[model samples]
Target: MSYVDFSSDAFIAAFFLYCFAFLFYVVTIAGKKWSNRDPIKHEQRWSRISFVTSTLGLIAHLTFFFTRWIGSGQIPTSNMYEFITFLGMAIMIAFTIVYAIYRKPLLGMFALPLVVLVVAYASVFPQEVQPLIPALSSIWLKVHVTTAALGEAFFAVGFAAGLMYLLRVVDFKQTSKEAKRDQFWVEFSLYTIVLVIGFIAIVFIFRGAGYQATFTQENVTIDSKGVDHSSTDTAEYTLPPIVKPYNSTADHMDSFLGMDKPLFEAPSWMKGVNAGRKLNTVIWSVIAGSILYGLIRLLFRKRIGAVIHPLMGDIDPDDLDEISYRAIAIGFPVFTLGALIFAMIWANIAWGRFWGWDPKEVWALISWLYYSAYLHFRLSRGWQGKRSSWLAVIGFVVILFTLVGVNLVIAGLHSYAGV
Candidate 1:
């Protein structure tokens, strides 16, 4: 089969392997009440199977990526869709490294599903071969994109660990068995609701901002003095200006239209709609995040102990913290090299200059800076435990903005991901 066909087949196999692994994990987590009286035996069996299946899936995933590279003759991250897939693979590799050191298979239970989700999302985009645009054909493309993605993967893992950590911190001893089961559902439900409401609110705010489009037109007219007057008509274009999700700017729009002199200019009022959309997205995200936190508290009746339980009897919070910190320590430098330095080099090569302040690039820099501060806060000032965990969470938030939010809400050159 051709490489493209082979890649597609590999994705299919990886999907099934991931699904099986996910099922095994679920069985292990919920097998306590099964016909087999020995939960420990079942857990052991399932964990073993999960590890094997996950490993197999990872292999297939890697093959798929490699085959695509061979087929395309370029780095995998030529588009937003490809970047998400790359991020998923990076996360899995990061998780594998963590697993190798700490032997924590449970983290895979959370992480594998995420990888599956990303891969599934990528499946929706067109997989056809497209030559790299002039801007993307550079060695920095690989280094910058890969490193940024690696950082995001690390941050993503950190987010999962943080959630797990938060759950461990909340005391669940006061609750009955049924309530304990309900606790997980409650937290997830609250999170989902906040996500939905916040999304709607953002849409409302942007719609309310009165987005407009401008068009430029050139007309030749004869004046009363019998002289020919060549005047450009700058009228607002009725159509909504096509603003990329991440790279919207007056300058970009001006440059985009430079080649096609205005038959008519778009209205001035519509020029800032893209910025309005971005502001709305940020506002909504904050609001949603706050509401989600509030709901978690409300669901537990304002008692911290009621919301979470300690780590599994065998695992210590300190150890979990250490594992998490170590992952960041290793992942951070790679992230810095790839996302910042390499990206800058690539941008310079592709765009004829180094820094454009594009939304994606800005967010990448922001993420890098945030993680740098995180490391400094932890190592220099000796911050640890809750403080360190919170920093990790914030660092991941910056990474999320760099990955998903930047593509979805901000208008920039990187907005091609159909976010």
Candidate 2:
């Protein structure tokens, strides 16, 4: 097999290993109350097993990265698929670091799933290796993308810990106005996560079934000589189109559940790279996520938060809060180095400017500022516990928008990475 093929196998192995690790971690927590086993010994044994499995998974992921790098003759972070996979691996590394510091096996229960979800989401994009464009062919590409992803990975761990703290501390049975508000938001956060999973699920389902739709759209570009040029490009869809591209018609669409045509054309103002398809994806995610959430609610017969909060009975909320804080604190400076400083240096080298108001750049700045305020509130303003956890949680949402949302919704210098 070629090195790329071997890397593909390694990637699959890593994904399965992560899934097994997540299950073992779940057993470490959920099987503690079993009839035949000592709870403390059971947790210790299973936690060790889970940690080993996750570490092996990380090793396999590393093998995939290096092998792919060797095969492609370029670092794999130039595109969405490779970058998200790398992000998943970085999250595992961050998780290992925090797990070592805290020796908390339960953290694996939260962290491994995030890794699995991220890796799975990476599969939603095309996975072929493509030649790097002139803009990305720099040594700084390695430094900037890897460091930034590593920093974001730490924030992801902080998010997991902060979320765990919330589940541990929040009163599930309270009915007062403030308590209700808290409950609603916690559930909403979970629902949002479910939406991402739903999106990945729907995409793979259609892709595996060989579903496809194609459209031809006209493009207009201005030349360096200030001339208008027109061209036609093909747009393809894996999911049935609810909304077609603006100023375009379908070349062909496979009938899905008897829906063979697009229901609407995207608005002219919504122009962006794959704007209509992205909007369709968002719509499908909400639809699938709501259905999945409803099913889970039916199975549990309670709010998802209430279902999870009980499992957190033995965990200390204060430790979780501190873990969240320290992880973010460690990540903040690294993010500044990667996302801002190294990024600016690379931008100057490539674009002959230190900064441009690209959507990705703006959002990166927003993420930096957001986390800066997070640290300020945590340290200078004396925010701790729930308030601090909330910041960590929301900070990750901002980071996600910077990483994924900006690429999906806006066309800019970074648009090539979206491919």
Candidate 3:
């Protein structure tokens, strides 16, 4: 089989491994009675198991992509699916680094499921092998896409850690009688897992059974005046018959193939509208992510920190905050160079224009500016702890929208994502 096929299978396997790790981590969190052990010993044993499983899963994830690169003879960011997979890999690597430094395996209890969700979401996009379009055939493709993905990955890790940090702060135990902090954490963790998995399933369903494509064959018709008008002038197209399938890959590929070209077509007047749409996608993702976070807290009848109280018992909040900031500090410059400078250079080479104000380019600048403001606030405004943590969280959402959501939902020059 081709590298694409191999990478597909590997992604599927890594996804399930992450799911298994998530389940194991949950069992560990619930302790011996629910997880089957004495509380203290069970907690320790479960921590070890969670760490090992997550490490193995990360290794599998890296191997999957490396093999994909070898198979495809190029970096994996050729399309939305590849970009998401690459982004997930970067997130996993970042999480592993944080885990190694802080010895905080509990973070994986939240992070791995996210990685799985994104990879699975990516799977919903068409996975077929297609030659790179002329515009994308450049060495800068590697530098731009890979660096942007890595930057987003680090931000994703920061967001996960920040959420955990928020949960650690609010003292949910002090907030309500009905809410025990540990109970809240366990419940929220599970809920987040469900939501992530559910979103991926929704995308899969939409691509598979929820939408149809209709293509009218190229045709022409002549008028009574013998004008020699082609049928294409009057031909009408209708939605194709819906195909139901347990798996989305085949259906998505069929739909994509049936369409003669890319999913988006921009009018001349809207030449740069794709860039605006990208900004909108990024903005909306941040809004949606914040709302989802609020809903999770509401469902538990407590604040976020209350849910993860047990994990914070021996851990210092200051340390967690430092780790969160440090990760962003390292990731920000890399993100700026990759998502902005490299992208502009590549765009200039391919389209003969570097700063076109295209939606993708504009949103990328927005992300760069937002993070720059974050750093400025940190240094000049003395933004630290909860305030800085919130910025990190917000910055990540912007980075995500700039990376994945923009390519998936927006029509732009970067529409080469083949969504």
Candidate 4:
């Protein structure tokens, strides 16, 4: 097999190892409640083993990344597959740094699964190494995208800590109505993760079973030079579309919806990269994930957070809250330099405009603004603990949306985003 093929295989192996390591982290946490031995020592033992295994996995994953780099004679940040995998690696690296300082097993328990999920999500995308377009051929492709992903990964850890803080401290049984309302938001965040996981799970099950469908769309646009382009004049396109938009009622043989053909068309301004198949996959995934989550809720006779919170082994909610803030504090400036500053530099070089209000750019700005507000609230208004924690959580959500959502659902200058 070619080196690229070997590297890809190695990548899959690393993903598997990360799954095992994540399970080990969970074992450490759960052992606290179930094991008869000194839970502290037991947790430490498993945590150590988990760290070593994850390190090995990181090594393997790195080897794959570098091998792909060598084989291609270019840095591997030019497509969705490369970018997402690298993003996972970045998150793992950031997690390692934090764990070294805090030695928090709960952190790993929360964070590692996200790393696994991200790697799994990356698998759904096409993995073939393709030649870069002129726009992506610059060295900035490596500098800008890699740095931004790394910053975003650190922000992901903030999300983890924020989540752990909520699970550790938030109490819904309070008699106050406000506390109950706050409780709903906390649970909603967990559901969001579940929804994404469900999306990923359904996609794999369907793909594994060789279930596929297609629809067609015709797009017309005026280029910068004022030249008109039309994909199809007729309502029906002869060639099959890879994905029909979510709002589409095209009335074709839609896979999950199983409709005859959609009767609707996407708006003229709602131009996309034909990433509707992904959207459809996500819809199926939500249905699948919801069923699984429902079954989980039924089996445990409690909410998902309630089930997992016990695995925390009574960690300090305050510490988790602080770590969440620290992560954002460190990550925000880095994110500004990479996602905003470097990205603008690259955009100016490629698109001839520093800021085009692209979806990706706009989301990055939103993340910055949200976190800025978070910092102000925390430091200025004395918002700490739950209030600040929620802001941290929301800030990272914006970051994730900017990282994944804009890249996939809202195609713009950065669509597919290796460029």
Candidate 5:
């Protein structure tokens, strides 16, 4: 088979292996219920085997990247699909290192699920390997983007550790209001992560599917030369979408189903070729996410936290704090060099300016600043435990926004991420 096919197969293999490793970790945790011997050795024996399985998954994951690199003749870091996959690979690599040092089964369990989520999330983006855009054709693309992704991977793993800290340290025995609130928010956060995975899964499973409806009334407006124009017009709506053998101009469109154009007349302010369709997809994704989380809650008959937290009992909260701190401390300077310094270098080479206030640039700067402050607060202020873990969690959220949110929400020079 060709390298392209090999890479795709490897990617699929790696995902399943990771899933198996997760199941192994679950076995390790659940086996404690039946063990009549020493808890520590039993945990170690099972967890070590799970770790070995994860290592095999990591190897397959590495093969996926290497094969893609060989097939493409470039580092596959140019688009959302590639970048997110790269982030997943780095997370697994980082997790292995942390797991080696700490040797905690719960840590692997907490961290590996996110590795799977990220790899799964990458699949939601378009995966074709298009030729490089003019601006991205630089040696700096290899160095700058790669280092930045590695740094952010550390941040991602730190988020896992922080989450572990939160779950492990919480006093589930307390029936106080503050304890209840903590429990609720923790469950909500877990629900949100699962919801995102559900959204992507639904979108994929329903690919090329469409449903239709007719709109009774549509309020329309137009701005011509700063003059306001308004009208009430009727149009069709599609739940998924229905396509027709028709073409649409900016001014004229066929009111038909099973076509690319949204039959609905979008509001004048909503500018874009497919603004209505994008809006519809967002609505559908939310609905799908809700459905998935609701089913899990119904089956468990409790909040997700109540189900998962008990298994987290033997994990050390202090280790979670330390590992998170260590990841950030190692990752921060690397983030600074790649995201700030090398990015400016690339901007100068490509755009003929080093410091254009591009939206992506601004967000990258914001991410760097947040991590800097995080390091300062932890090291100088002697912050540790929940306070430090919270900051670690918050820092990764900022890094995530810099990586994904900026690309989706804003339009700028950096918007051409392998599209």
Candidate 6:
């Protein structure tokens, strides 16, 4: 097989290995209570096995990265698919480093699934390697994207550990108003994660089924000469359309679940030709996520947090909090250097400006300032445990919005990265 094909195979192998490692980590925790098992020996043996499996997966992932670079003759971070897969790989690297230091099996249980989810999400984007545009043809692309992703990977680990801290410490059985509010937000956070999974799952489901719809959208523009220009663009959808593009007509739509056409037109305020499609996707994701969450709730007959809380009873909340803090602390300076400093340097070379106030740049600043505040609150204000954990968790969300939401929802210089 060709190197690119081999790289694809390696990626598949890595994905399965990560999944197996997650299963083994789950066994390490759950099997401790099994009859006829020595809990200590069982935990030790299974944790070791899981860690080895995860390490092998990371190796396979690295093989994919290098081989793809060889085949493509370029670093793979120029596009959404490549960058996200690289992010997943970076997360694994970060997880492996933290796991070695802490030797905590529970970390694998959370971190591996996150790696799996992220890699899976990356798979939804197109994977063919494309040549970088002139704006992206720079050594700084490698430095900025790779370093920024590595830093984000550490934040991802921090988020996982912080989430674990919450699960371990949150009072699931409490009935008071304050406790109930905490319970709601924790459950909501878990639910939001499920939404992401649901989004990925639904996307692949329709894509595999070869579902498609087409729309013709018209655009009108006013030039400096006071002349109106009109143009047409095609909008396509793999999922059934719940909403159609603004000022557009369906070229063709395959009937889905007895619905032959969109139920509504996109809001006029949504300007892009693809805005309707993106909005439709968001709606579908919510639907799929709600259904998935409902099934899980039904299966357990308890809030998801309550179910996970029992598994975390033996874990140390203090250790989880420390791990979360340390991971973010290590990541903060690296993020500052990559997402801001190197980015500005690259920006100057590409656009002749170091600071453009583009949506992406603005959000990147927001993420930096947020993390700066996180560190300040952590070190100066003496926030620890729940407060620090919450900051870590929320900080990752801000990073994600900076990475994804800005690309999808806002048009700017970074729109090239959007799917």
Q: Which model scores highest in lDDT?
A: 6
For each candidate in the order shown, give its overall lDDT on alpha carbons.
0.66, 0.93, 0.68, 0.78, 0.77, 0.94
In the range 1-419, model 5's lDDT, one tens digit per residue, is 97868999989988998898888888788788778977777877989889988999889989989899889877888888998899899888888887788777887777889889899889878888767887888999888998888888888888888888888777666799989877776777787787777767776765545434433333345667676664443333334433211222233333334454544444555543344445555566677888988999899987777777787777777888989888887778888888999999999999899999999999999988888888888879988997888788778778877887677656778777625
Residue pairs clashing in model 6 are none
TM-score of each: 0.69, 0.97, 0.72, 0.88, 0.86, 0.99
Model 5 whole-model lDDT (C-alpha atoms)? 0.77
Error of 6 at 245 (Å): 0.6
Scored by Cα lDDT, where does model 6 land?
0.94
Sorted on lDDT, highest at the top, how do the candidates line up?
A: 6, 2, 4, 5, 3, 1
lDDT per residue for candidate 6 within 247-338, as digits (tens), equals 99999999999999999999999997799999999999999999999999999999999999999989989999999999999888888999
48-159: candidate 2 lDDT, tens digit per residue: 9999999999999999999999999999999999999999999999999999999998899999999999999999989999999999999998999999999999999999
Per-residue CA lDDT of model 4 for 259-311, tens digit only, reads 44543444444454354544445556667778888988899898777776665
**Model 2: runs farther than 4 Å from truth?**
219-229
| 140-215 per-residue lDDT for model 1 (tens digits) | 7777788778867877777656555545554455477765654555366336435645554444444455434443
Model 5 ranges off by over 4 Å: 36-38, 208-268
> Looking at model 3, how many pairs of residues clash?
17
Count clashes in each candidate, considering only residues at least 3 apart in sequence or on different chains. Answer: 28, 0, 17, 15, 8, 0
How many angstroms is residue 41 displaced in model 2 relative to the true structure, after the best TM-score fit? Answer: 0.4
Q: Is candidate 1 or candidate 2 better by lDDT?
A: 2
Question: How accurate locally is residue 181 in candidate 4, as Cα lDDT from 0 to 100?
Answer: 78
Tens digits of per-residue lDDT for model 3 on 6-105?
Answer: 7677777788888888888777765554544467788778778887887787787887888888987877778877777888888888888887888766
Candidate 6 residue 296 Cα shift, in angstroms, is 0.4
Error of 3 at 171 (Å): 4.4
